[model samples]
Target: MALHPALTPVADLVGTWRGPGRGEYPTITSFTYTEEVTFTDVGKPFLTYLQRTWSPAGDPMHTETGFFRVAGGEAVEFVLAQPTGQTELAEGSLVTEPRGFATELHSRVVNAASAKIVDATIRRLRLDGDELTTEFAMAAVGLPMTHHLGSVLTRTA
Candidate 1:
């Protein structure tokens, strides 16, 4: 099936990417570890996603996987699950302009440890060339959460 030209910008993201990243939360005494995210497009309207975080010592920390779909022209809905006995459903919108590809995604993670759920908003921007930058923020435990993660992935055959 041919993808609508309007969806090309989104379809161009159909591939696999890997990189290292860090995370921070007030609950932790210090920055614990890094992470890697894998995005796969199975020739569908949505992208299949998986993310894994590892301790600085190289031990596995946690993992999450889900599907991300676009709706109503700039809105996106994500359905995902975590190995820590939790699942998330988020809604947000995408904004693409002359500057770059920007996406604001809000997620509600259920069955968390400290709080009932986490409300996180993620933003990603495609920069000049193959570079991509992303920022993540959340509201949990009645406070605000923020972080960063991104990578420059070359198409692999």
Candidate 2:
């Protein structure tokens, strides 16, 4: 099938990207990982998005499969599901500048294992000719935490 019209603008992200990433909460840790994101269109209004994250230490931390849709001009919604017992229904609007595209996503993570919910806000920035960066601010387990998950990812494929 062909790509969705709304997702065509994000076609650049449909590949493998690698870089060092940091996760911060009460503590900070660094790791190297390769992120594989694929976008598929099924003749729908939205794009089917799948992301696999892997580290040198193991296979993959998580995989996200979802649909990307647009509304209110530049606003976007990402509904994702994971096999590790989690799902996120996030919504955000795009902030496009001369440099890149910035999306501020507000979501809630439902932990299917513990029946816990976490409120999260993520800012994902993608520069025109640079790597992608995502900063996450979350209130998980009744604790406020802010960190960088994918500090930067260089295109590897």
Candidate 3:
């Protein structure tokens, strides 16, 4: 099927990517995991996103599902939900580079009563050819915004 015109800017992300990633937070020990991320086009203006991570021993660590859309010009948005009882609305801009694109997103977080307290988050992602690099900062659980995770992944499908 032909790609939606609105999704042209992020067309490169419409595939499965897998690789290693490291995560850390002020409240927990640092650890490494294997991560897989997939972006699928459902014949709509937005792309469906799914991400999952597993520990080195293959235990499931984290997962999230979301929708990504280009909201005209360089503006983009991502609405996501996590099993941890948190939902996030992120808005950002996408800048086209010679190799690919770079995005900087800021998110407003809402947590369920039973969920951990998460106030806000910032994420930066750069896609160059088949490599995807990402960094995230978060404010939560009495901690101010601080680096939380980073990963470099390669297209797997």
Candidate 4:
């Protein structure tokens, strides 16, 4: 089957990416992790997204499920939910670069009553050839937005 028209703009992400990542926050100790991210083309206007991270010892750390959609024109939307009780709607524009496309998305967060206090988040993704780099920052726990995680993953599929 052919790729969906709207998904063409982000088609480079349609595969699995895996690599090492580092994370840190003011409220917690810095750590190292193995990150895996997948973007699957489902013959629809959106791509199914899944991400997982594991500790150096192979213990599971975190996971996220989301969908990536073209809102209209060059604008894109990402809807994400994590087991930690936060659902995020992030909107931004996709721009072409020398090697691939990049997008910086700012999200509106919704938290469950018992979830940690997360006010906002920003996710930045850059794809260069077969390498995918990601940066994430968030505002939570009464602290301001700060850098949290960064990863560099290679296309494995």
Against the unseen true structure, what C-alpha lDDT does each candidate score? 0.61, 0.66, 0.93, 0.94
Per-residue alpha-carbon lDDT of candidate 2 for residues 103-140, written as tens digits (9 for 90 to 100): 87788677786654555656465645556665657676
User: Model 1 clash pairs?
Assistant: none
**TM-scores, in order shown?**
0.72, 0.76, 0.98, 0.98
**Candidate 4 residue lDDT tens string, 2-112:** 779998778888999999999999999999999999999889899999999999999999999999998664988999999999999998899988888899999999999
Most lDDT-accurate candidate? 4
RMSD of 3: 0.7
Of candidate 3, the 10-residue stretch with the lowest lDDT total is 68-77
Of 2 and 4, the candidate ahead on TM-score is 4
lDDT per residue as tens, model 1, 1-157: 6664445556655555444555566655545455555667666677788767777788987788998787766877778887655677877777766644667666777775743455554545353234344455656555676553443433332
Alpha carbon lDDT of residue 65, candidate 2? 89
Backbone clashes in candidate 4 total 0
User: How does candidate 4 score on lDDT?
Assistant: 0.94
Q: What is the lDDT, from 0 to 100, of the residue 40 in candidate 2? A: 62
**Which regions in candidate 4 have their CA more than 4 angstroms from the true location?**
none
Ranking of predictions according to lDDT: 4, 3, 2, 1
